[model samples]
Target: MSFKNLPLLGTAEIIGALNLSPKQTASAANLAHRVAQSAWRRQPPHKRGLSYEEFASTVSDCAWLTMFEFGALLALGRHHEALLLADASRMVHHSARTDPPK
Candidate 1:
């Protein structure tokens, strides 16, 4: 899937939360696209054992959840962590591929 298709890719709300300028937002979108593309190619170590369909689904789901986590962190004034979560691949690689938080 294209990173453009990633959940909440370039919403105004996210832009505001991050206090991104127009140029910064564009740069961020490009960075997200690059990160997603790289993750698709490498399948992160934990995800390597999965079949193609599973891997795709896992990444998609994680992307969505990470957006929510990003928002929450921002709301909690956790700007630093939110910025890190902005890099979708970091969570995709470290978080679960299938399991949701309990």
Candidate 2:
């Protein structure tokens, strides 16, 4: 199936978990979308699109979960820690994408 026109894949679920304001939900959804696109681009061209299993796995990946945790931090008024966590998560994902496979 085509993922080209899809909205953020897990927006509803993210919103449910975040239970935050619109701006916060939008921020969380944007991060989730980025993670999903990154994961999608790693797939082979022939199979490069959203699949149920991949969607499940991508949303559950540590990177995305870290973003979810970020939302929780915002809810708890821990902005500094949330920013650190997001930066760390992005670094890890970038490293994974750039590192040579063993």
Which candidate ranks first by lDDT, i.e. highest?
2
lDDT of 2 by residue, 1-102 (tens): 222323344545555665667666655545555656666768787776777456646454455556555765666577998899888887887998999999
TM-score of each: 0.45, 0.46
What are the runs in model 2 whose C-alpha is more than 4 Å off? 1-57
Clashing pairs in 2: none
Can you tell me which runs of candidate 1 are displaced by over 4 Å? Answer: 1-3, 8-10, 44-58, 61-102
CA lDDT, every model vs. true structure? 0.57, 0.61
After superposition on all C-alphas, the RMSD of every candidate to the true structure, in Å, is: 7.2, 7.5
Cα lDDT of model 1 by residue, 2-102, tens digit: 33444664455666666766565555555555554566678667757866445545655456445544655555567888788676556656676666889
TM-score of 1: 0.45
